[model samples]
Target chain A: MTRQELFEQIKIKQSFLCVGLDTDLNKIPSHLQKVADPIFEFNKQIIDQTADFAVAYKPNIAFYEALGPKGWESLQKTLDYIPKNIFSIADAKRGDIGNTSGLYAKAFFETMDFDSITVAPYMGIDSVSPFLSYENKWVILLALTSNEGSLDFQFSELKNGKPVYQEVLEKSSKWGNPDNMMYVVGATRGEKIGEVRKIVPEHFFLVPGVGAQGGSLEEVAKYGMNSRCGLLVNSSRGIIYAGKGTDFGTEARKEAKKLQGEMEVLLNQYCY
Target chain B: MTRQELFEQIKIKQSFLCVGLDTDLNKIPSHLQKVADPIFEFNKQIIDQTADFAVAYKPNIAFYEALGPKGWESLQKTLDYIPKNIFSIADAKRGDIGNTSGLYAKAFFETMDFDSITVAPYMGIDSVSPFLSYENKWVILLALTSNEGSLDFQFSELKNGKPVYQEVLEKSSKWGNPDNMMYVVGATRGEKIGEVRKIVPEHFFLVPGVGAQGGSLEEVAKYGMNSRCGLLVNSSRGIIYAGKGTDFGTEARKEAKKLQGEMEVLLNQYCY
Candidate 1:
């Protein structure tokens, strides 16, 4: 999808919600446990139910990777099942040496067909540039992640008086423009998102801490929104695991609808 | 494998050489192309020829992941084919939030049976801690990589007068003991390996860039060697793809033997 296409999806849906399909077999509803490919079934339903509200689906790759080849198959099926208009984000934080990274780009962008992939910036230019070569495909680099561990290295003070995340944003932003690049700015720190916004205002921010991580959606919109509605606020456990019964998809839809309704208000209030 | 076991393997072989199974289907000898599973067949040949000289095997995951599920199956077969005594390192630079990291741990350590997995430390402590939970398993964190891009963020000066890699070494060293933790200290810059060794004295360093990437084996041994001969010097293309003809395995063995010969001389000169 192009930058304009992504923004158009947001406008058409009245939301920039990116529902994370962090599917774990142990966490799925009991009724679905006996199915042939339970993980895919669960995700198929989640996509079916929440497609109306969500503009994107971010599948945390680790969840699928845990189950080995079978898990990868399930992931492929789920990707094929998602509505084409809804953007796909492979939340696989992968980076390596140049040649190796090119292979990874082949894996996610060519083989599996993700519109975007989350990449770690620690390896620098070559590790990330391979993913940017594909037109309409995106590279979501990690900036200020919501995890507590983000402080260990990413938030450290540099001699230049800027935090390491700022250094990451400043340099990495030059590697790819807003059209092909995005930043994973955690919503756990709304003000920090504002700080990141100031660093790279044009690139889309894949905000991951909006729901279960206690990031207020309102604060994210107020501080991080751009004229393009440059944010894809992600909610994983909060929406997918909304209920324990067979009616889990309905419960998930309810939670997604609530967020979408709020996002509609935020889009009108902030981006407009 | 435990630290003592790995060290014992190093002593037994008199070569801390690690064979990197960066098996690319397109690059394999044309004869293997007719095989049922050429990737695995190629890797099996490489491992068979190199095992006597190498103390460890590091399979670069991206090469396999690029092939999708079939590639994943080949990787599992390759792991199963490796000699039981040799250490296995999944060169999968994976790390995520805590819960997701745990799943990655399950993927590489539990499901796949790798003795260790390379993890990118940009996410901080939580992303790393999960991999350390498995007893007798290792987390080889990226400290100083060999690529030109390593200069991008890794070598930047921090406010405390230390480079970012040093900060990673200092903070991350406390998270896991030397027994369960190692560092990927690239050998592309020989002197940089020495600097990393000083910050992280006890833990083993999986040193890449010895051959195809152009770092001297002698320089790596001189600067990066420790009390336990604490270096697993990796040579990927130089050893594995040494010959493009039908006698590729024999040619690979010749290259590995040359490195092992040098390593034996280094072991006697530097340590015992």
Candidate 2:
């Protein structure tokens, strides 16, 4: 999806929350196990309940991959279940050799029907450029992550003096315009969001690590938000797995609504 | 698998080639189209034909993901098709929020049964750390890429005066020891291989962009090889899709044998 379309969705929905479908078989309510595909069953319910509250649904590819063939079937079914208006992301951080990368582009953008897919830019331009070739498709590159280990390399001072993450943000910006390229900047690093914004101020960011990871939505909006409400704040475990019982879907909707309500306020304050 | 196990495989085969299963449904021969899952059929044939010539089989995740439900099924079948003696990799470059990333770890290492996965470390420690938590599973972080666009950010001079890719290598070294972590250093960036080695000499490198991208195998081995044969040179289109006819598998085997033969000589020259 183009940046403008995403912005429009955010404006229309009065929300910028992107619900993450990190579905786990074991964690899903046992009552749904009898269904043909428990993972898809869980996702369908969550999407049904939270569709009104979220502007996007980001499915981490790993979760679907774990269930083997059955898990994958559920993931496809879940994608089919999502409302068309909401942006869909295959959160698969993929990058590789050029020909190989081209095939990957065909997979995520042409075949899977996702609006966007998370990408790792470490392989440089070729690895990411293939994804950008598709019109209206987005490539969410990894920038500054939100984990404690982020200190291990992201913040490390390079010989040129800038942190490694800053270098990625600056150089990778040239590959595609803000319309086709977004970034994965963790909400946990709220203090550094301002710095990230300066690097690619126009691009959207898939911000994870909120809710259960302890990152504050207020901080992310204050520092990272753009005029377009260019932030898809994701909350996985705290939402979908909010309850272990039969009301898991309802509980997930409550969690999503709470975040969406806050996001609406944030949008009003910053999305001018 | 640990670095020791990977090295042993390389030694036993007398080669360090990692056959890239960047399988595309459209590219498979007409004979294979009759199968329920053509991508898997092609991968199985390639694996069976070339297993003796390769130490590892790296399946780029994009190919499988593009097909949606069917693509994922093929990926699983392909993974299972590979012999246990050969290292298997879900070339899914994944890195995300911590809790979600932990689930991704379970998907690739625990569920799908891959020995390692390609990761984009742009998210910092939290995104990568979860993948590293798996015992004997390796995280191949993006380091220096080989595409023309790589010059945009990967080579950009950081504020600290070093290039961003160099800093990524130096900082991410601490996340996992050489045993658990590897780096993706493109073969196209031949000149910089020596510089990368200076930063993380012990870690194995998953090098792509060799055959089709015009990267020289001799140059990569000369500058990048360490005492442990620290490289898993990959070739995708130039090998697997060498021909588009019924002899595709035969052609793929021939291409793999050529690369493996070169790799065997390199291993001997480097005395690994």
Candidate 3:
């Protein structure tokens, strides 16, 4: 999706909520387990109910991959079911050498038709530059991830006094414009959102670590929002696994709506 | 495979050569295209020819993923065909949050039964630790890659005077022992191999960029080899796609045998 298109979705929906479809077969509603593909069935319901509130759907690829080829099929079905207007993210943290990365870009962007894919920036420019070649597809590079391991290498101090994540934000920004590039900034660190904005203010931030990960929507919007509503606060388990029963889909919609209601207020306060 | 089993394979074959199965459908000989599942057919022939010389078979996952579900089926057949004694590396640079990383571990290790998988270390400890839980499996972490982009972040200087890759080596070595952990050190920079050996002297290094990427096998063995002949020098295009003809399998075997011959001499000089 284009930058203007994404901004329009956020404005129209009154939320920058990107619902994470990190679907796990064991975690889905028990009643759906008997269906041909439980994960896809669960996702189909969730998307059907919550599409009104969510601006995007980010499928965590690892969950599908664990089930082997069957999992990939389920993912394809889920992707096909999601409305085109809602941005689709293949939250697969993939990057490799240039040629290999080209294949990955083909896998996620062309074959699967995802609007974007999360890419790890450790291998540098050639590893990431392939994804930027696709018009309207974004490469959401990993910056300050919410995981504890993010502290290991990403936050290491550079000689020039910038942390490695800052170096990533500064250097990688030159590779692609704001339209084709975004950064994955963990919402757990609200202040770091402001810190990341200082480096690249115009770029969107795909913020994970809200809800189940205990990040506040108010703090995230206060620090991370830009004029274009440059924050996609994601909630996976908190929203999708909210009440695993026959009415699981309805419960998920309720959870998404609650988050969206808050996001609407944040959008009015910060972006407007 | 255990570290001891790998070293034994190196000694038995008198070669530490790893053949990368980065099979690109477009690049393979046109004659093979007539066959059903040409990628797998090509890999089957190549594996049949070169299995005698190669200690490990590393399939670049992106190449298969680009083809979608059918490609994954080909990969499954190829994996099942590889000799049990020979180590298999899924050259899939995958890492995520802890729970998600566990699914990835199940995908590659438990489900696919790959002996090892290459993981990018940018996410830190939790993202890496899940892959270490499997017995006799390996987590070949990316240290120095053989791409131009390697210069971007892998070489970032830390305040303590060590490079970012060194910090990765020092910190990550604590997460898993040399038995279960190896590092992907690009053969492009021969001198960096020596520098890496200084930090973790006993660990095995999966060295890529030898033939196709202009890296010298002689220099890699000189500085990188340790008591166990600690290196798996990979040559993908150089060996697999040596000649695009009906006789491509024979040509691939010749290339692999030539590398294995050089590796035998290196073993005599360095390990024995």
User: How well is each residue in A172-271 modelled by candidate 3, as lDDT tens digits?
Assistant: 9999989999999998888999999988999999999998888888999999999999989999998898878999999999999999999999899989
Write one digit per residue (lDDT tens) for candidate 1, span B49-149.
99999999999999999999999999999999999999999999999999999999999988899999999999999999999999999999999898988
| Clash pairs for candidate 1 | none
- The docking category that best describes candidate 3 is high
Q: Which stretches of candidate 1 lie over 4 Å from their true place?
A: none
What number of backbone clashes does candidate 3 have, counting pairs of residues 3 or more apart or in separate chains? 0
In the range B8-86, model 3's lDDT, one tens digit per residue, is: 9998999999999999999999999999999999999999999999999999999999999898999999999999999
Output the worst ten-in-a-row residue range by lDDT, candidate 3 chain B.
B153-162
Worst 10 residues of 2 chain B by lDDT: B151-160
Minimum summed lDDT over a 10-residue window in model 1 chain B is located at B188-197
Return the lDDT, model 2, position B149: 60
Each prediction's RMSD over C-alphas, in Å, is 0.7, 3.1, 0.7
DockQ of each: 0.92, 0.54, 0.92
lDDT, model 2, position B105? 85
Q: Residue A3 in candidate 3 has what lDDT?
A: 91
